[model samples]
Target: MNLTPADTEVTGKPASRAKRPAKSAPGAATSAANAAPTTTPPVTSSPLATPTLTAGVASVTHLTEKLAEYMSPSDLKKVKEAYRFSDEMHLGQVRKSGEPYISHPIAVAEICSDWKLDAQAIMAALLHDVMEDQDVKKDELIERFGAPVAHLVDGLSKLEKIEFQSQIEAQAENFRKMLLAMASDVRVILIKLADRLHNMRTLDVMAPAKKRRIASETMEVYVPIAHRLGLNNIYRELQDLSFAHLYPLRYHVLAKAVKAARGNRREVVKKILEAVKNTLAMAEIDAEVYGREKTLYGIYKKMRSKHLTFSQVLDVYGFRVVVDSFPNCYVALGTLHSLYKPMPGKFKDYIAIRKLNGYQSLHTTLIGPYGTPVEFQIRTQEMHRTAESGVAAHWLYKTGDTNMSDLQQRTHSWLQSLLDIQQQTGDSAEFLEHVKVDLYPDSVYVFTPKSKIISLPRGATPIDFAYAIHTGIGDHTVSVTINGEAAQLRSELRNGDIVEIVTDPASRPSPSWLSFVRTGKARSAIRHHLRTINLPESIVLGRQLLTQALAAAHLEPDLPETLIERLLNESSAKSLDELYADIGIGKRMAALVARHIYGLMGGESAAMPVDHANAAELDPVTICGSEGVSVQLAQCCLPIPGDQIIGQLRRDQGLLVHTLDCTVAKRQKQKEPDRWIPVKWGSDINRRFDSRIKLLINNEKGILARVAAEIGESDANIVFVGMDEDAEHVLHQLRFTIQVKDRVHLAGLLRNVRRVAGVNRVLRERS
Candidate 1:
């Protein structure tokens, strides 16, 4: 579809038409074009021969007829004039479909016309490929037609001169370019979608590799774009076409099975249809019931994803019933359920809570004749139209320009979001990534404390919801309550859940939130916050490590920032902040650098009396005993808050502050002395920490549970419980990782476990 559109690769000059004079010549819309005399349209739009692919004239005349239905005489002539000009420009070229290349754009225009686009849009579709395929300039187009049409074509054309590393990169770059253009003018996307649709219709004529590449890109980008725009008609077509090209064998197999099913189920379907028709009439329900089959791609997806064959896909046959009013939908649903047994959990009332794309219907599956599952959708006529067309319905169902409808309003929100995401994510690749994440969300709709519906992508956590509500709420999200019960921030939301995000004024976004957040908004906010906030925190940690190392070398830790700068002047880094950042991010070692700086200061090679006045600067880290991500007790040492701790600054690995004199800490200190830093207990130690302990207990009935209960009595939670097998049957060593406040709490838990009937010995694990 794009290849014929000049996609910026084809150069050309103006093919003149009766319009504005050439303003910006070659390169301004600068491309080569075959200039022509200006005699654009006969002020009247006489109905031309309807354009059918198999029409009398397979030339532009065929396309002329298709436009005859919608366009006025004057508009039709203008379209024909643009077509003739484009034809002359692409005189000898042809598409991979082996048709005159001009035929492609004409077909694209026809598609746009079917969507009820304006004269300018149809004309833009006609000339879209001219700049890329032929030697046509933007100025020439502007001169021949109007600026609006030219702008639309320019937006559709691919930037061709820049070389991409691979076909995929070029495709991504092309999409990025096109998306920005579409964001400025919504019509650009409609035309581009038409262009892509036409291209896909003729894609089978291309090579296998090219076909798959185009089809895959279509699946990932265009299909989702159509869906996001609520262009369900186009979305389905693109999906089916892409499925055919991407997985031909699967599509063929599924198509054959569906065909066979239709033949086999004809009689049964007829009987059920009649029964439903009669039931509706008797109940005074006015409705139109029609039998429908799922698309090949839909069936194939179910097969692949759900691991089911064609036979097992129960709801392959479906029915859509359109009624008079919203209330009638429920009436019809009740009537259908009374007529047949409804399958449990197969009913979804989207009418009450519409899908994010604005689809609404009451869906129910029932056991039809022969035990086959028959799915039914009940909606009003307007809902039916909106359901099928999505955002496009508002435009397609109208003649002239209409007021902005609800569908358009939501779409505008999505469009503006692209610009917002682009601002937050500067890299084009990253921008694409963020956009893609939002594009294809399989949503889970939840509720607020006020019972307001909040729909988010499936697998999205409460943290994502907090961020979605507002950055302030997200920053201060201290706790969550799902249905009035306390839950963690990482809790995955289910449908119908009433989630409450409890905020504390002092709390901030944690680095750990990034691990479970599923939405682009939360991911971006957390990343932005981390990049800005972590630098200072890491710098402080680096300085602390440096100070402790300097103290260990019997040197004064009172050096000011300026003093440290002079000491590190010989290094490439210019300032203390730079050196601190380097040390914090693992680029340099604190102890080695500190010792080197001490040597440069020309310190005496002797010990000095120290009052340790700077003990306030080297302070202990405050941590809750709970597994709060960043802070952790070293498993080898099981250091409690009261223990004298030595911290190791493992870059990106977080800190594993260990108790002094622990065997593992001693080895790590010896191997990487620079990594060892000073640490102590903070006054406000809250939450529990897991400590491994060995409990030798006699193997007895329910003995393990008894020991666990005893540990639980000590207010300790069982983190892990495993038996050391291959020991005597009567006596066994149980290895447990139990959560406790500290060594003192563990001591209390050990006594409790030792009191259990089968207990022999309870000792803290050290090896």
Candidate 2:
């Protein structure tokens, strides 16, 4: 807890240690008194006193009393067993604050109880750290508690014991494990979130640097994950606590500003509540209304992000109106909107289109009598309960309600997509990359031709939706229909729009699609499908051709696959399966793989040259001439229409393309540039290429988003966006490396970029 003035005096510590630096003169000649040096101590000179072992027993008793209100007799007995086990395991352990470690587990358990989670989660919370901190074994936990409870404990335990290269990596890996468990059993993440919240609340006891790192990691990883999982109560509290420690100055200032604003707007809030109550009552909509305060973190975020002052923050106060049913929620929205003039475009109907996290509400920002914008959220009593407790509401509303037929049908789509993503992504880092991109909350709900609604992230194009529905649909999608009219597949979908996909069965998956698709599931599926259909052919043909080509240099294709697998695995390819898949789609250089394979197998076939005479026999081609034979820029690397190039003839890799100046190519050339032959774009060559370019512009309001929309309008596809590097002066650079038809199309796109409102300049990159 942060100290108050009275608390500071009672604790016998200064408000800030820096205020009394213990030294008088800076450079004065030293006498006996002046010669005494000074030291800077911590702000908190002492820790909170430890709870006694007797108090530990009383605390468990207190917890048992709390549990009595929520658990059954059998569950209560299980809880007692867990408490006893944790208390015994942590018998001699103590926290840095000198408190019995048992207190930590008790506190964590109390937090889980607040979420009203299951008995297993509560028990797991009480023993989360026992396996890591003590010598307790998993078998002991399983024997004492049930296997389910033990699994939760083990999942939590790994997060503490695992060593990672960096704190961020460790947090990411832990979060990944927690999410995987949540996917199988939702309670694990719920318990983990509770543990994180309690940790953040008491983070002040640690050193300042450690506090900042912990707070930052919590804010970036756990809070977002919790929000994604719909744990709103924990999400809000964690975000606020992290903000308090991560940016103490900003937190205090924002808190003071919000407090002052609330003091001034108390009458306004009261009047609005009265007006809303009267309006609802007249409509015969029975409801319970409560005021809402903007968290300090929310305010601080707005001030720094929107560049607004406290006075300019309009939606600082609001109301959460809970009614009896979904119909009554709409009734209340109608009544409220009728009484107040809603700010233009400030209404959001999340009730019909709930967020990915299962959040549902009808939100509107209205201008009151004084022109101040006050936001109001209307929901059913069920939604209110779920809004506060989130996934835990599954237990609260129906304890034994395992028949989640409705929810399963709705949620299974996303869950199955996760499995698909994991399958397609060869490694954890790539999976995480794709998952983080999808976790962002800006989403739109569009409908299928059959009128089924699908929620996708905002800026998600019809192509993304197509892939979301089915990989085959996306792979073969030629066009789309939006509300019964022909629409481009790249067109952004909006709420309530009906969409239909037009596909061609003969069409193949384009490597360029990876740039546009948003969800991890879609990307994974596309890659998986492409590999399954194409890798075997490429590998067989590549091996045959490479075997013959390597024979010219006295090498064999009979080498063990282990050497090649080890090399590629480090780059995230699992086996020859992934390597061949990438080679088949022009995503990976076959020669690079082959050369590495040969090197590992102790062969000196690095000098083999492309066989122009047999190039056509090995792979079908549109161009064949002695000048360059059928060289094409690898769409994966987008070796531009006018650039130096090299050809690596793989065993089965038809022809691998690379920039002559590519580092990989340079290294290969050092050994053998004869293996790297010159190639050029054919005159009639027509294909899309991803030529990336960076633009630095003043960070004007809505500039970056507007630029993205403009690129979308140009029929060009932006593959990714690096986060803004700086936020101070609207001076942020966006690196938009997108796919365009050819050199002419790329030129046109660059010209369009130059015309964007905030774009300072645009240039085609040389590197």
Candidate 3:
């Protein structure tokens, strides 16, 4: 992983040519021919002398020594210059621990150097805190270092100058800024992660509340990000540190327990190790085996989630076998299995199907030494490197190997997705929400019809799958099939299922998809599409609602231009469409706005107060069941045509139509009577409506199929079906949400279902 001279070609002047001024004898004539040039500053202290420390903070001399191993002389010179400048900028600043603030940046840069990051990244790391803490400007850094370094420094800086409504909002906006920068250049997040790791390491000096807050934030955001980027070494350390700070007692208790377990199991571990080594030696396989210990957080999480005791967590101690080649990984796995009994359904081959983060290993569990389960992971040396370093291996190895390139590509793809989500999302809080949704580490690998592997979050539906394939496909997805059989779009996909999506140009996303989708891409795409179509539809609906309200006062539907202008001005609307949209979306009451418009027109009845008793005499608003988002059918009662329905004007949700007899609607009416509007079904209704029904049937073979067939024969499409068995009565209670044309269509479907053989009773379900 060390860099050669060719890899150290940084953008700057040659080291020898760019030299610092040397001290001369007092009043001596300067001669250009005799002048001495050097890249490093003249040493005031002897190299063998005791090191100088400020508040227990070491000097940058150590950093330069480490850089000398892989960095070119010129790049090394630039890094020392950066360190000196940063040290000067943070002169009197001190940390909470009373250490010189320069120590923090030095520690962060050392972490980056450990990763073999280029000289430019090292310089950026040293200066990352200056812009945020010292108010240093980016242009100054550009003049001092270069544009690339300056950009990285700027990316690390927070938006502290701007005031936000809340601290969470401020944090979210800052993260949003940093993420967008990371999408452009991956080094931003890499440096930022190093910075966060150092802070977490030294977080004990902070107040209790601040410690918990920072620890929780690190666990929620940075920890997942580290895991996503495949930084296993850093990821594990961060998890342990966060666990230690967030739950000090639990972390210490688990740590102690693990320590004791190690002593008690030492003999068993030794026996298994010898057996595996002897078996592999006989098989003539070359491998390096090492024991792996689980992190404290991992143990605590396992105990809490799976309800296991410390001893029940058998895989806490495991082994990793690093081989010389990919084929040897499986050879070692087989060799080890020969020495012990392999556990069924406890093996996973990640090499054939790599994780989304580009992690590859062959994992298995074996019964070792007195029936104890031991976990083993087999991988090649290169795979091991990639697993530990992840995308950072691209720079560390600099070999352009297939594995390294694939890891880089996968990371870039994920970062690019964040940018796409940012473009679709406008609010910082909402963008952060979407990012959190995407950050979940657990993923399931499924397949496209063409055998292409597509990885999605666990519990992700076909909607998420469609969007993962393409935004256009997701927008136009009409149906899908799982494993060559028709399946609901909301079905939870399983591993290895072949998902085939059917799209139509006329098909569009439904708002209900937001309830089941697990990916942010699908959610954002649906919202963007809905917003695009909502405005125009809302304007039209608002006009109809206002016109109906105006008719109650004996006014014309089309008002004079002067009166319209006055109404727009009085309503604080920039345009007539804005005014109507507000009314359509229920932001303003149509009746009050109509009365206000009447007064603008000098109508005598405009002075009359609104009469609630006469509300029934007004013209009714007509809904055709296809009024887009501006008009919606309430899901509580699932109102359809021929059902006596009333409209409830909900702010920002537009008009919700519900059955007049719905108990939920009655409760709402008692609280907010003025929000209720008289509505009627239009003659041109053409779409199907969902109605729920409950059925009790005799428990017998093929009874469910018989009832479903009866509903299908009546031309009703079943959207969802749920069943519960009554063992005491030997009957089954089945609930179905089916789509039909109207109340009449639903009645016919119910009648068919009731006539099916073995049917005990059928009734419409209302809330």
Candidate 4:
């Protein structure tokens, strides 16, 4: 019987694939591929009677033969069995390119075999689509193949059953699932990459829009993943293929230009190759030197990022020297430098400090004949293998080599980080965002106090460094120092800086840290900590707000369980604390909540008249400046103790205390008067508050020093200092943010600063 058209509608599969009937019951033999043959059946009389079918069978036979080289006979037999099951499940399905559906999985399997993966991984690759397209359950695969293969196949499958709110959410959730699975078994991602690579190789049949979308995903996600895993070959190929589909015109133009450039630069390349080979020979170094050209996508990226034209993109032609030993790598680099004039500041020794992905090479740029810039990379043979295959080198070599073990460890560390981020992030979309942030390839290497090297993304701050060291240290970081000098927590780290993080038992993550942290682990940890603490803090503030509102209405702070339950029911809150949190976070106004409670208490609302008395008459919520995130002093006014302050209940932000006359608080009061509440300084305030004072001084050196000395003499610590020049007046306007105990302390400090010589004027600056 001919295959029907009902089974070819999968998302990534080609549309022209001939469909088959609906999937049969589990464990049932459906096609001649799966049926037990009593004897050798004639090809023409069998179900595979077409020419394409004969070719497909021959391809499988060839694949089985190839597997025998690396796999045991029993393992090879199992692989053949998996192919048969896959063929039966995909019976009569053909691709848009007119290839049988089974060809896709077989191709994926072949790719994995090239990596010399174990038989289970190869089997999972062969049967990857059966569970995805044919409704073959994971348990059924387990019953047939085993749990390991089943798990890999299941990890490869997408979340088709559960629905998502949007396509983006669905895609993000799918990525999250796959990444988590990869953390459990790195083989899953390896096989998944193989599947994607094969699909990308055959993506021509897809529509333009689908091509662009898939290509964009491959570039944005898979390419970086490949690079991160040290799969240089796959990484480069995926980048080029994605570029071809995403920007076809540019890809073609660049490809043609590169082809022409190659011919034109052939003589230069030949000269460099000969010179390098001669130099190595004279040095008695046994090294293999080969010429190489930059990938089209790499060239394109360089051009766009550096704003350079194709002609200006020098160093596109390069050479790789594979040495016999690691030490010879440096010897080769020195030999190349001697043969050509080395470009200034164009040498890097990745051999001394390996990349986060375990890539090691010594790179140098030199001025060649006719002023052409040529690049060169030198590495050992084993390093070359790892550079090309990355984590796959662990399996490809499989000799328990130290380098391979190190590569595997690095890959697993990155995978473990993915799990850590996933645990802290609750939303699939947010988890994807954090992971993408971590995937950036640009990195800066820093050192710890103990001289331990730590790699972080460029623009990473000390907070990111702390988090990279350990989550607990990040959570409790109170101060930091760079190169033995105290530094700001938000300061961007540079290469080779010795970062030291000091922690306190009471120190906790600050919400402001979220603005500067560059690592996913730091961001996720901060967000998770905030989420964990916010609810309870909100409930406490909500209780205080509701109690204040209740006091205004002549009611007791405590209510009976029945009354509280009624309020919870009426507000649709899960509990009293939830209702309190809602009110505290301004999700529900405390006044309205109190009014509802009054009604429940059988009080006459008409008689209450909503207490519009003077705020001075009502009891105020006290602030000690250590109320955690539930209470924050407004930065605009920097309200200290003894200032007339008012609290604004902000949605999801708890209570923000501001000076009564602060411009921001005045504006917010006019807009949402109901959210404003009375607040006052506590009787026993113990911490310092930040206050800013501006000084206009003569433009003389040492003027800043005199002012700083005065502030120090007054026992006021300057937290930050900013300066601007007033050319017209020949003066420097210096603004200092200092910490003081209260308004009284700040006034005294201002007096002391006014006595400094060269000081023109000093005033407390307020927004």
Query: TM-score, each model?
Result: 0.67, 0.68, 0.76, 0.75
Q: On TM-score, who's better, 1 or 4?
A: 4
Give the winner by TM-score: 2 or 3.
Answer: 3
Worst 10 residues of 1 by lDDT: 42-51
lDDT of 2 by residue, 1-767 (tens): 11111111111222332121233342221222122222111111011111112212214655676789979999998887777666665554445454455666776787677766678888998888777656477897788787888888876755655544355555456556655666666677677776666566556666787677677767766777677766676777777888888888987777777768878989988998898888889999889998988777777788889999888888887789999888888778878889998888988887777877778899988888688888889998877766776666664222245676343333444545656677676445556666776767678889998988888888788888888788778889888889999987667788788999889989766545665777777677666664566556555534444454444334565656676666665545666555554554444454565665655666553754545565434432222222121123454455755555566643222355776667766666687543443345556655556777788787678888888988898898888676465756547777877877666777887888899888987776544
> On residues 1-767, what C-alpha lDDT tens digit does candidate 3 reach at each position?
11111100111112232222232432231122113221122111111111222344435655667789999999998997787777666655556665665676777787788778898899999898777656678898999999999988887777867766466666678788888888887888888887777676667667787677677777888888888988887888778887888898988788789889989988888887888888888888988887877777888899999999998998888998988888889889888888888999999999999988889999999998889999999999889988988888774222234554777877877887998898876456777878888887899999998999999999999999999989999999999999999999999999999999999999988866877999988887776676556879878878888887777666788888888877776565788887787777676788888778777777654584555566587768888988877788888999989999999987545789999999999999999887888899999988898999999989889989999999989999999999998769698899999999998888888888888899999999998
Q: How far is candidate 4 from the true structure (C-alpha RMSD, Å)?
A: 9.2
lDDT of 1 by residue, 371-406 (tens): 988999999999988876676566522223357776
Clashing pairs in 2: 541-652, 542-651, 542-652, 546-651, 698-730, 699-730
lDDT of 4 by residue, 63-135 (tens): 6656788899999978877877887788776666655667777777877877788889999998887876778
- The reply for model 3, stretches above 4 Å from the true place, is 1-55, 163-165, 395-404, 538-624, 641-689, 694-762
- Global Cα RMSD, each model: 11.6, 15.1, 10.5, 9.2
Which consecutive 10 residues in model 2 have the weakest lDDT in total? 40-49
Considering lDDT, where higher is better, how would the candidates rank from best to worst? Answer: 4, 3, 1, 2
**TM-score of model 2 (CA atoms):** 0.68
Runs of candidate 2 with Cα error greater than 4 angstroms are: 1-58, 159-174, 278-284, 396-402, 405-412, 533-643, 646-767
lDDT against true structure, model 1: 0.70
